[model samples]
Target: MQLVTWNTQWCCGLDGVVSPQRIVQHARALADFDVLCLQEIAVHYPALEGNAGHDQVALLRALLPGYQVFFGAAVDEWTPDGQRQRFGNLIATRLPVLQLQHHPLPYPADAGVRSMPRMCTVATVRDPGLGAVRVMTTHLEFYSKRQRMAQARALRVLHAQACAHAVAPPEASGDGSPFQSKAHTPHAVLCGDFNFEPHEPEHAAICAPAGADDSEGAPLGMRLWDSWRLLHAAAPQPPTFRLYDRRYGPEPGSCDFVFVSDSLKGRVQRFVVDAATQASDHQPVAVSIA
Candidate 1:
């Protein structure tokens, strides 16, 4: 299975043009992805840089036929025209979606710092090579360090929760009830714009083992292995943001990543970053798993 993750910046390219079609085209040029995870997708929010309030979810769904689109809006509000405006993460999968969930990450209020609510979109899909697997994409708080750390902790908690549920799923009805059993696998691929540099403490926090108290007796929490490190070892990670656009700062670094559960470590075949695409301020990272 091939998976790609990118922060679209609402589809605004380096030329200051916001085109969902171009974003799709650029990602397709990178790889024939079985799953695509996009962050910073806006809906009916024309105020964003170069955005014209287009429903990016619908546009992406239309562009990628036969894919199931799942959106998790971290910032949801009603515009002056009574239309809904949402901004958050998106997951598009060609695989069969067995279950879908939206998890709102920790967003402790910090009046001094400007930050928005963050969320992770989780989907359990049936992959031809890996069978049932959990996939999640998220965008963490950018301006608030405290919030970002909290959000990272929340992600670890979520992973442990999923594993617990997978081990002891709820009882199902014998009759053809609406509440049928769905596939839930401990193996997962967590990818997205983490909003923190690869060397930051938040990155290490994410990879740290969960405490025994946090796991609820389901063994030690599953460790998430960085796909890049597993494949490249001592090599320095390529820049994924601020490569050309320096709106936030001049220094370029990698803030986007793809992490697979320890169970799926050996299955990680390849990891590549499309550094040439200017379709968005951030580059796309693709991973091939067997």
Candidate 2:
């Protein structure tokens, strides 16, 4: 199934289509995606230059008729008194959603240090061909490295639990299959702005198998694997962040990523970083796996 993960920057761009409309346009552009994971999807925040923003979930549901919508709101508050300012990650899928979990990531050691709170939303998508699989999306902490590391660790834990639950026991299926031996695990696609460069030391732990010890030498329970490396089997040399647009040249790569379990590496058909697009400060990323 085709899948896309993009950070639209609340759809504030030169197109003037507005956040809701941009979500629609972008979804339409990606035509046949089985799953679409989005970050920075604002509901009440207006564009940087256009009309007042509309409900992103409602608008996108219209754009993607066959897909079911799931949103994880990171913030729900008003600028002053009554206005609502809600924004967070979103998951749209054509696959049947068996269940979903939205939880806050781990915070840094120094709680008082101050940083933006982040969240990771996990969704169980049912594939008739492959049964059920986990699809997750999250925007990592931007300012604090400690927080990001902790968040990454927490994400792994959550992913392992969700994945464990997704598998249907042979007896539960009523097929009367005697033994329930799991020889191979299914796939889990984790996408979003990790806020860390590719191959960064902090991510070494996240990229490791579930329950492996981290860089700190402490035991980590849930091992979250990297789908990119699973598919590529290697990290691309140099950085993958900022891009020189129509105005500038090659800048630096910032935050963006797609990770999956090691077993499904060969399934990745292609991985593209569309940083040249003017849709937002960050470019869109698409990964097609069989």
Q: Please tell me which predicted candidate would have the highest lDDT against the true structure.
A: 1
Worst 10 residues of 1 by lDDT: 210-219
> Residue 218 error for model 2, in Å?
15
Best by TM-score: 1
lDDT of 1 by residue, 155-257 (tens): 8778777777677787865566767776757889999999898788888878877545544334575767789999999697899999989988888899999
Q: lDDT for each of the candidates?
A: 0.88, 0.69
lDDT tens digits, residues 141-228, model 2? 7778888888887777665654454343233443536444332234677888787876586677667566453333223333555555
List clash counts for every candidate, in order: 0, 12
Error of 1 at 256 (Å): 0.3
For residue 81, model 2's alpha carbon misses the true position, in angstroms, by 2.3
